[model samples]
Every structure is written in structure tokens, then in C-alpha cells.
Target: MAALTGLLFLGAMGTANAADGFQTSVPSAILVDYDTGSILFEKDADKRIAPATLAKVMMADVVFAQLRAGKIALDTPLVVSVNAWRRGGGPSGGAAMFAEVNKPAPVGELLAGALVVSGNDAAITLAEGLGGTESQFAQMMNAQAQAIGMTNSEFHNATGFADAGQVSSARDLATLAAHIIRTFPDYYPIFAKPNIEWNRIKQRNRNVMLDAGIGADGLQVGWLKDVGYHALVSAVQNGQRLVVATLSARSEKERVEETRKLLEWGFQSFRQRQIFAADKEVGRAQVFGGAQSSVGLAARGPVNLLTPRSGGERVSARVVYTGPLRAPVTKGAEVGRLEISRGPVKVLDVPLVTTEDVAVGSLMDRAIDGGLTLMGDSVRDLARRAMAKLHK
Candidate 1:
């Protein structure tokens, strides 16, 4: 099937990354606008790596889902097994909330432990309590991951224990972070707080940059000796929030610097621009056997983007849909997408919907539309062949 594509050429592209020459050395990284989910910048974003403690973001997400569903309350008590204590608590000599062995801790405290303190013990306890076993709880995590669109992520344990299967990409991690903040607004404070005390043990937020200012509010960071440091950072400047996921920084300082640099650059280099106003027709999608040959398409809301602040950028716009849609299309039905790209990076993608309903056309109209479609395709093919021959 031929896709309906509209090609557009915009003004001069700016120096946001071109003239400024922004580069990242982190093995895998992605910068995203939280509101629009735009890929502002990416470097090997899909490369999978053992996420270490970064996996806890998903663990917290599963627990949050349980809470949101009323399956568990923040005050619900979960017992810390010896296995959890031995492997994740003080006995393991890793970051832990120091939850006592065999003692029951409240779900809220455990969540605080896991998120604020990066406590493996608290995480395992919640896993065992909610799913009956850490391994089983990992299944719950996987399900939640899929439901919320963390496509390139997997889980093996509640605490980010070293497992070959426990892996995710920078983009997936950023998606997880954005999902958490957006879905669980009430519970999000735990991720930003500087400290949470559990079992008489106080641990500062593992995210070192949380209090370092620059509007760094929430998110998580992780490190494994083998994989270096991985972090998911969310920050806002001037009311625009950006989520950054970076992996394989050689040191904690490097992780903090690389992510912070990206966030600062994102805030400084981009400015919001309105493209299509709400309810305005963006383009038209062809209709087969309809009252009209094509249906007008518009976005439900104003189409806007955080584009380069300086000058016009080289942008390609396309109103893309799979087919000349079937007849009887309803108004406001999602029909296609308005894709805008800056060079190789897709900066904006908004859902395009039918601006008005279209009923089935008469047989004569249908026949003419069919003929036109056939002719269009044939012409396109012939043009491609002719161009190929000319090039040769």
C-alpha cells in the first residue's frame, strides 16, 4: 500500500546541535520532552544494557499500579524475608533501607526505601508481599511494563539485582520515568525528596543531582560495577519538562554531568512554536468510495513543538496515513499523523483526526475515485522508474 505523504521544506535550520556541535559520549542516551514525547536528541537510544538499579523505576511503577488499582495500600504491611534481607538489605552491604530481617514494613515505607533510598531490601519485600515471590513479582513488573509501553525493557527481580535478562534501553527508561510522573502524581513526591527514614536508618535520595538545583525534581539513578552508571533524570525550566535517560557513564560524576548538560541544553536551546491551531485542518487523507475523494484532517489540539530557539530549521513535514480510507468515516476519528522531522530526528508527531464525517458515495463517484487512485499509483511508479533510468 502506498502511504499518503506530504513533503515540506521549512526555513534555515539553527545551531542548536548543528552549529553548536552538541555531542554525547554516553554509550546510550535519549532526551525527550515530557509533554509531547518528542525525541529531541538520541544516541544509540535502543541499545539494550543491563539496567542495574535503573530497573527499580519499573519496579516502583508496578507497585504504583497495585496502589492505583486499590490492590494494595501504602500502609499495607509486607514482611521482609531472610532472602530479601540477606540479598538486598544490610547483610548484602549494598544500598538498603536497612529493613530488619523478618520484620513487616509498610508498603509506603518500602516504596520510600526503594525509591528515595534505593533500598533493595524494601523493594524485595514489596515484591514478595505483592506477588508472593521476588521472581513472581518480576512477572508483574513485566506485565506493567508492557501495558504502559516500555517496549524494550524486561525484568527478573524487584531489586535491580544483576541478571542477564534484566535489561532496558535509554529510550525505554525515559519512557518509564515519564509514565511514572504522569500517572502517579500524588506518589511522585517520594522520588524527589532528599531523604526517607525507615527502620531508624535514613538514606538520602540516590539521585545526587536532585538537590543540586536546576529544577531537578525527581527520578532515579543506578550503577553496577560492570556497567558503570545509568540514570533517568526529569527536570523543568520555564515550565517545560524534559526527561533524559543516559547509560554507561564511566563514573557517577560523569552520569550527573552528562545528564545535567543535556537537560540544560534542552531548556536553553529550544522554544515552543505553534504549527496548526486546534480544530484546524492539517491536511487531507484520501477516501475510497466516499462522498468526497478525500477527507479533511485536523488535530484535536493545537500542534506545537519545542523547536530550535535561534532561527528556522530544516524540517520535513508529512501527513501520513495508510490508505484512502474506507467510507462512512466519523468526525474526530483518528485517521493519521502529522510528522515533522529535523534531519534524522523526528521532533513532532501529532494525531490527525477526521475534521468531518463522510458518508459512502454513489457508484459513479466510487468508480471515478477508483480510477483516479489507480492512475495516481501508475504515474508514481512510472515516475520512479523514469528517475532511476535518468540517474543511471
Candidate 2:
């Protein structure tokens, strides 16, 4: 709720459990609609837990960002450090790509190993290549997580191996998976690959949603002796895509079965619909000392989301900004945000831009608006203070 502060809210406010009707055995799980960034379902979605190999998705994303920015090419050769080899390779009793020590593994192979096989060696090599060391790379991971709004996650190492402090939530991992799909379509297919061969060792990918007949393309799976199993998976049905993250399952069967159930339920229950057109006015905002008292607002693109196929859900929309904006507003300039929700769950929070320009108003208009704003501010401030006291 702290994230909702400082912005105007024009939607209904209340506290209700998200995805209340559905139940599952996994301790932390989330279902997200890929297109509209909606939370279709969630249970303990934000409770921090060790994600184990699921953290490789974050490591992979960092490398993807670097590749997209032209910082490194797929063909660039990365050295496999002894530290990476001994700790993340075959000797560690963890998943490994088995790259030879002192040999240079190409960036492309490392990406595939990390994503397809969940190879710690491949992940560590990429971390060292991109950030010079695993510890430093963890800092970069934390930075990227914050940039992308994975607020509850923190990374202590690139391999998801560290003190208990290395942690992420199911919601954050799902966000990471969607971020990969949306930002790196070229590399995203690596997750869907069935297997990868390195050092003459071939390992079948653990994420077998494709074989499960659930429309899963690629993602990850993990197990820790005491921490249980976790998976971050995505699936598509009839061209609609959804991401599901399940953490701390009791066994391999539960991890797969529970995730498949959530994905199928989401696909069956929702249909995508365009609620607002790209150029049409979404709402309006007051403009002080301008040619007009208010300016029309529109989204940069069409607003679409997975609405219940049966319809008639209690949906609400909001416009957020600190206004009345003073003078000379330009058309297409961003001024606020539009947030839409169903029941108490957030759906979309998109940018809002001015629909038309408004030039500066006359001196008399400015004076009047200033006086009115002063009075309004005082009244709003008093009300805000009272609300703060109540909150305390």
C-alpha cells in the first residue's frame, strides 16, 4: 500500500484477500496475466523465501539486458573461473554445465546452460563475465530487481547459493519471467529448449511443461533438501499467455501438478478485452492557470486485460497525479497514471498523457486559480493529516 501513496486514487479502496476462492498446497504462489500485468490469483505471493535455482531467471535476465544493450555479444567468450568451476560445476553436488576450467565458454552457451539446465556453473560464469564477480553481480541483480519493481527480493549470489539472506518471493520470480519474455523475445526461447549439451554431458531440462501438455514453453525448477521445491513457469492457451510461480512445494509431483492447475484455471476463467482505445480519452485532470480548467487524458496504447469470461466482476479504474498542473500543458506529455482493479486486486497501472495542449491562461485567470488552489490545498491538507492520525 505504501506504493500507492503520493498519487491520487480514483478507484474503490478496501481490503480483501486476493484469489480467495482458489486453494493450493504450495506455500507461496502467484498467477499473473502477461498482457495487462494483472494479478489473477495469489497466495502469500510476497512472502520472501529462498528460490534456489529459480534465481537463475534473474541471472539470465541481467545477461539478457547486457546483450540487448550491445554490451556483450552472444559470441563473446567468457572465462570459466576455477571458483565458478569448483563451487558451481560438478564438484558442488549441484546442477552444472560442466564447463572446463580456464576454458572460455561462449556467452550463448552459458545463457542456454543457465536457463535450460539451471546450471550453476553457467550462471556463475555469466555473472563474472557481466559484473566481474558473483558478489558484485548480486548487487547488479538487486539493482535490476528494484528497477523492475521486484520490491521484496534480494540476491546474495548469482547462483542462488548463499546464506539464508539470498531470497525472493513467488511474485518477483514471476515478474522476472514475464520481463524476460517481454524484453528478450530472441533469447526467451532458450528457456523452452528441451536440453543442452556441454562437456559432452547432456541433461534434459527440468521444466517439462511442454511435455505436460500445459502449453509451457520454458522457465525453471528447483529443489533443496530442507527448502522443498519451487518453479516459475509460463503457459499459453488460445494465444493468451500467463505466468505462474510456485515456491516451497513438498515434492516434485506437487510442484508440477500445482503449477499446471493454476495455469489451466487462469486460462479457463479469463478472456482478454480492450477497455480503452489508444487515442481515446480515459479521463480528465484539472489544469490550473491554463487556457482550460481541465485537460483530456488518454493512454499511450490500448488498455486490455483478462476479464472474467462470465463478466460482471466488480471492476474499478483510477487516475493518479498531483494537480492542478500549472500552465502550458503539451499534448502527449505524460502527467499521471491510470490504475485499474477488479475487487481489491490490481490489474493495470499505465501512464496517462495529455490529450490536448492548453496554453497559459490570462493574468486574471491565474490569480483566481491561485486563490482557489490555496484554499483547496489547506482543506485537503487538514483532511490528509486527520487520515494520517487515523493510520497511526
Candidate 3:
């Protein structure tokens, strides 16, 4: 009876702590390490959810591709077509840059307006400029999504709005955001725009992190009654970058708080460690026929791992491979493997290879050695048999 009471008290305490740390309003969320792609915390991240304006990340991908290919420039002026303006103009769906039809806006200004103010008109202009139509631009978005290995996402339009079928999972959104951060680093600064200037008009960023008292620098946010609230927030601190994606948040305040809590937990709970330095000499392998009998080998992996930061010793390491390698070893030949473990968990299995070439011995030398070995073994066996017979 006493043990049962203690158990109940422990369970209650655990529940209380979880409640304190976790939010009550957000329906889905994910936090990840931007450098290593480690998921620190997640809740229903794979479940399909509405992307809302967060779909703009895919749109941005297409635009950045054009910039990288030198097909477009930030200062290039794009003419707004009637179709783009009409498609983007709506009530309470997405903010518009109020671009006039047939008028031109700088590519950079449109990008800023899309990111800072979540402008649908700016996105449509970009889509038309890059893909000739919003529908075709969506194809580019989906293709890029597949290219980046986003399995749980599909794009129906260039802008994430209240389309009946436009949707993406939180995990897919996080993957897309990570790709943007890694692939188009230069354009990433646009996400940090607290306010943007276009056609002599200024609009403030809808992302709450700009003033949410956190060190939020880049990313986007969205809200639609059907989709609730969503955001993809990214921040870098102390050289570590973390991306948090929240979906179906009840309110803007909840989205900001939930993002902060998730990021804080990730940075505070884990750390990056160098388990094996790249190309550092790890072991040696014997060469069958070579100038040297053996050559030094080193690990072939990054030699670093992200793990819990709570003061643990260096991982236990062991060499795993068929050693005493036979014959002429080519320099940099992969031969062995290094297995590293922290406690019972294996951190990494790194491939080890020869650091330098080893030439095989001459055929005459190999023949002579084989003959000597065979002769010595035969003589020893015969002598042992003869001695046994004499003793008998």
C-alpha cells in the first residue's frame, strides 16, 4: 500500500513537470538540429497538416534556383500581370504588396514583401516571373520538394492558402526549411526582415519572433482559420542553428512560446561532440606484398556526433574489420571500420582506410618465403613422428 502511494506521487510529479514544460495549445510541433538533422523533440510531426503561408518556403526555393542560375537578379524588375494580382487578391487570406497590374517591382522587394509580410501578391508575381504561371510554379515547388527528399509533402499552389487539397506534414515542412537554410544561404537573410519597403509602401513582418523577446532572426509564419496557426522559426546561437516548426497552434502567442520552449529544450539538453576526427589515424592494416608490412589507417567520417551534453566520458572505440590486409594496398583504400559506443548505444561506425599506398613484394621474394615456410613445417612434422616411433 505504501509503495503504491509513492508510485502515484511520482506519476503525479512527472505529469506536473511535463505540463510545465509543454504547451497546451499547439497541436503539432518539431525541433531539430540544423547542423546534423537530429530531431530533438517532436509531436505528431509526420501527420499531414495544413501548411498555410509556410508553403512560401517552397516558392522561395524556386525563386532562389533562378537567382543561383543567374536567370534572375534581386534588382531585376518584374511586371505584374492581371492574372497574378487577381489570383492573389482576396479577403483575409494572404497579405498583398498592392502591386498595380502591368507595373514592375524589383525582385528583391517582392521577395522581402513575401517573407516579411507574407504577401500573396508578391509570391504570385515571383511565381509568374519564374514559372510563367502559378500552376507551373507549383510543379517546380513539388519537384524541389522531391529532390530534397520531402516524402510527406505536395504542393498545389505557389502560395499556401485555403485550397481544399494543399497540405504538408510538419516533418516535411521542417525538411524543406532545413534545405533552404543549407542550399540558399544568401537569400536566407530575407526571412529576417522585420519590415520591408516596396513601391514606397512598408509592411511589417507577421512573424511574432521579431518581437517575441527571443533571438529570432529568420523564418516565416502563417494563420488561416481552417489551418489555425503555423510557423517555421529558425535561429542560430553560439554557432549552432536550430529550426522549429509548429502547426495548428491555437494563437500567435502559443506559436511563439511553443517555438521558444522547443528550441530551449534542444540547445540545453544536447551537445555536439567529436567522436572521431575526419581522416585522423585510427588503426593500421598489414599489407600482403608491400615495401612496408603495414600501413596506417584513419577514420573516414566527420568524427563528430550530437549527444546529450550532461558530462559523459569519450565513447568507447573498437576496430572492426578483416585486418592483416592481403597484397598491394592502394593509398586511401578503404579496409577497416571503427565502431564507437557511448554506454550501450553505438554512436558511429566509421570506415577506416589506408592513409598511403604500400607496394607488393616481388614475385621472387614471395616464392622464396613460401618455399622456406613449407620446408620448415615439413621437417618439423617428420622429426616429431620419427622421435615418437623411437620412443615407442
Candidate 4:
């Protein structure tokens, strides 16, 4: 049985198809489907690079978590610490909210400063207020990164100030952006605010996509002397939301152009096709010890795929399971996987679960089924060996 399952797994390792014709100057980039977590296009997406102000996204995430837990309210006042003042303030020579030292600001205004204007001081102030110190707040940032499965991220500060070990990946940033969008939707609107008034300084948002007439709503942008310009831009069109992350572009204009190209390609190049509805039978699996000889298998939710719009290639699907399955089987138990492919390229794979339970068969029925299972196993072994030889 184990060998048969291995063979089945090998058989299901589907082929790959290239998403060609799209290119970008950004060294690291990724475009993902917000609904399905599908990678439409990527370039060195996992390579860790300085996230610069993009780290504020995670900083905002930590603050949003506190807000959701009721530990702090939007109007909660936080005083600017000396560390926040000296490093992230006007003296730091970076973007700042120009917050006065020892002056208190509301959590809502601080968030606006940090997100809309990329204020390093507001980020540090929020960090210190929440975590007692910037160092401790960095610990919280790392812990949150782990919780959210940002495998290639590390944080040394909330302000995203250049540090020795501070780095993140485009893919990880996309995941973080998606998480923020899904988790704190009530607070997400602040990212789109064009500018915020704090300490009498009016700074416009650095995100150019908002002004480009694209469906872009809210997200973060990052830039550093050595790291160049990076942007995590998301847009919605016709109910479809897509997030694009770019790192190390030559200039702000170049980053914006590259990100826009990726978004346009993603929206214009692919069309979604619904393959299976929730709880709808996709196929059947043979059951050895159940009263019935076979059980229906279905998808837990609607299965959809984004396929090339040209429509020249045919899409195929197969249900792969280790069988004959022994009863009793419970409904909704994951029994197999559904693999969908366009031509030779596998596009989507989802679990195939039993739609109904199967009860144990009678003693005589079990005996008959047991003998048939042995015979079927022998045939499967031969077929597996034949297939292996053909591959060689």
C-alpha cells in the first residue's frame, strides 16, 4: 500500500508552463491573487532585501492587533520618547511626522502618520508605547512575522531604519499585505488617505498608484539609500484584488512603472474559470470494507483557476487517492487531491474529501472485499512497475 501511494504521488507531480512575455527591472517582485493565493508572476521573490519603510506595514499590523484586542483604542495617546525623537524625528534626515519631543499623539493620528506619510517618528512612538522600547517592539515584530508565516523576514526596528540584520522578501511582504487587508479591514482605509496633518506638517503619501486612476486603495512604500525604491501596491478591478510587491528598483518612477505593468498584465492576461462548486462531487473512490463499493468525493469550496486568456490550451483534471479505501469513512474526511492542469502545466491543486460516510460491511462482505483488495493490489503493483520502467 505504501509503495502504491508513493507511485501515485509521483504520477501526480504535474508539469510546468511558463508565464512568458512579462518583464520588470525590479530585482525582486511578486504578483499574487488575493482570493486564491496564486502566484501569477514572480522574480526572485524569496530573496531577502532591506524592506526600508515597508517594515511599517508590519508595525501597523502589530498596532492593529492591539487595537482589535481592545488593549488600546484609536484615540489612545502615546508620548514621543527621546529615542523616537532623535532617530526618527527631523534630525534623522529621513521622512518624519516632525513630532515634538515629549508631545503626545493619538493612536489614530500616529497610524496615519506612519502609513500615509511614512513617518519614522510616529512608527517608533507607536512601537515604544506598545512594547515599552524599540528593541522589545522588534521582538514583537519578529514574533508576529513568525505567526503569519513570513519565513524570510527579520526586524531590527519599527521605523525600518537601515540596520545590519533587517531584511524581508517580496513574497513575504505580499503575504503580510494580504494579511493586513483581511485582518484589519476597518483600519485599512487609512492607507488611502492622501495626507495627514500632524504637528502642522502636511506630507503627501508616497504611493503614486493612488493618483494614477488605478483601483489602488491603500498599502506601504519603502526606500533606502542602498536598497533603492520598493513598493507593495494592491488594486481591485471588477471585484478581483491583486497585490504587487517590488524591491530594489532604480528609481521611484521605475518602481511605479514596473508595478503598474505587472498589475496590468495580471488583470489583462488571465481569466478565472470555475472548475468545481463547493460540496459538488468531483469523482469517486473505491471502498473495500464499506457496505457500498465506492464513495463520492468533493471539493470543500468552489475550485477556480486563473488561466491564460488566449484559450488555446485545454485544461484537464484528475482525482488522485490511495485506494481502495477501507471503511468506515466519515463525511468531509480528506481522502485525496484534485489536480488541475492546463496542457502539461499544473495550475491548481485542492483536497478531495468524502461527501458521505461509509459504514463497515458484514463479515462475509468484508472477507470478499479483502480478497478483491489483494487482487487489485497485485494489478496496481504491476502497473506501477510498468510505469516506472517507461519513465526510465
| Candidate of highest TM-score | 1
In model 2, which range of ten residues has the least summed lDDT?
Answer: 1-10
lDDT of 4 by residue, 168-200 (tens): 999899999999999999999999998888777
Full-model lDDT for every candidate: 0.82, 0.82, 0.71, 0.83
Native-vs-model 2 lDDT?
Answer: 0.82
Clash number by candidate, in order:
2, 0, 5, 0
Residue 1 of model 2, lDDT score:
9
In candidate 2, stretches whose alpha carbon ends up further than 4 angstroms from where it belongs are 1-20, 377-392
> On TM-score, who's better, 1 or 2?
1
Candidate 3: Cα lDDT at 366: 47
**Candidate 3 — which residues are off by over 4 angstroms?**
1-25, 90-93, 280-303, 311-392
lDDT score for residue 184 of model 4 = 96
Candidate 2 lDDT over residue span 1-392, tens digit each: 01221333333222123444668789999998898877778889989998788888898888889999999999999999999999989888888899998899999999898888888999999999889889899999999999998989999887777558988998889889998899999999988888888889999887766688989888888877688899888888788899999999999999889999889888887776777889878778777777666788889999776666654455678777767777899999998888876666666788889999999976755665666666764453444445446757
Worst 10 residues of 4 by lDDT: 3-12
What TM-score does candidate 3 get on C-alpha atoms? Answer: 0.70
Q: Rank order by TM-score, top first?
A: 1, 2, 4, 3
> Lowest lDDT 10-mer window, candidate 3?
1-10
Q: Write the per-residue lDDT of candidate 3 for residues 1-392, one digit (tens) a residue.
A: 01000000101101011222444357787777777555555667778876889988888888898899999999999988887678774433448877777889889988887888888888989988888888888889888889987888888887787777778887788888888888898998899877876666777888877676556678888988867888898877778888888899888777877777777776676777564477777666544434544578786656555565554344456665564466678877877766654444443455678888777665643443344433543453344445446757
| TM-score of model number 2 | 0.88
